[model samples]
Target: MTSDTREPAAPTLQPRNTPARVSFWSAASGIGLIVAVVVTPMFWLPYGSHYTFALLMLGAVAVPAGHLGRRRGKRPDARDRGLALFGIVTGWLLILVSLLVFVVFTGTLAALGLLFGTLD
Candidate 1:
């Protein structure tokens, strides 16, 4: 066969309107973090409990997502990478925000308690 000189085919671009699919569990876990951020302060959960919850959510959801992405993409696509990163950051930021909220809420409560001459 005569040698064929071809530069090889370039990858085709996806349509601009094609939306990237999000992994269901990955998103659910992220939402779980958001909930923890809100609920911890509202319910007056101890910081340790909030931290524990965040850890469980990460282990149960985010780690599995990374594994699934690795299986699906071999080298994960931007969408997969973004989902994985968001999952991680969601858990971390939730913990951080929860701690901040907890401190502020407790401080305010303490100050108010002192003002009333009784600790609640």
Candidate 2:
């Protein structure tokens, strides 16, 4: 048999079992929802009928982010699906509440205007 002169081939590296990562959007959505819930009440305290448009803005952002987070969380490498769902639910709730507040405020203003004969 001829003498083997070639060096042995190096062993291939194997992939390690790494832990899955949390989705950033998911975390952001959740945190934002929480903050909106906590801070929005403070606004209500100052004026029960004024300065609540911020809730609409926050809900608008959180809803989309939560949807994206939920999609990402579906992947095997990402996590926090529950938090994403929570964000989505709370965001929608906030939007509903904000809309109701706006409607009431506008109606009250219109009624006052009519009463004072300002809307002729």
Candidate 3:
């Protein structure tokens, strides 16, 4: 039997050249959702309703932004896909809830007016 003279080489770890980056549109979408939530209470303030609607419309931008963000996140070096998805969901929820509230308020007002014969 021949004696082994050479030692086996140790395993080596490869270093990453760059860190993954968070998608910008994803961050923007998340920020937009936060702003929308914060502005929701303005509906009760005088002349604030218009601003609230405008902000909500602005928040709707997140939907498209989130979509773009999600696509970006699919890349190997991009991140924050979950944040993008959250933005998309919250954006739709805010719009739907606002519409529901508006419809309910108008319906209730009409019912009250009709009951009191004030609608004519």
Candidate 4:
């Protein structure tokens, strides 16, 4: 039997998987770290602006991560979800705690100055 008109089978391409994990969550962590580092230096500006910028960057990372995390071949485990939640919560907590510490330190310094006659 001679097959002269049959088309060749196309090669199947495997989809990438690791990027789904690294791009979103990893990038988010980086952005969160940057925000934490920059907050103190730029604290004089409005807090809302800083928070909004951070949140926007987080959402940008999340969009790709969300899609990558839900692939047909692999399902996200409880541990992954837990880790993500923990990271987010920890970031906010760090910010809150740092702000509190700054407030307390400044307040104490101001009070001490007043008491000692430095700011009379």
Comparing 1 with 2 on TM-score, the higher-scoring candidate is 2
Worst lDDT run of 10 residues, candidate 1, spans 14-23
Better of 3 and 4 by TM-score: 3
Q: Candidates' TM-scores?
A: 0.40, 0.58, 0.57, 0.37
Best candidate according to TM-score: 2
Among residues 3 or more apart in sequence or in different chains, the pairs in candidate 2 whose N, CA or C atoms overlap within 3 Å are none
lDDT of 4 at 102: 62
Report RMSD (Å) for each prediction in the order shown. Answer: 9.2, 7.9, 8.8, 7.6
Per-residue CA lDDT of candidate 2, range 25-75, in tens? 433544565465577776555765433566666567667777777777677
Better of 2 and 4 by TM-score: 2
lDDT of each: 0.52, 0.62, 0.59, 0.52
Clashing pairs in 3: none
- On lDDT, the leading prediction is 2
lDDT: worst 10-residue window of model 4: 72-81
Candidate 3 residue-wise lDDT, 1-117, digit = tens: 998888889876442212112223433544564465567755454644564464467456656766767777677766667766766776666567557656776898899889889
- The alpha-carbon deviation from the true structure for residue 77 of candidate 4, after best TM-score superposition, in angstroms, is 9.4
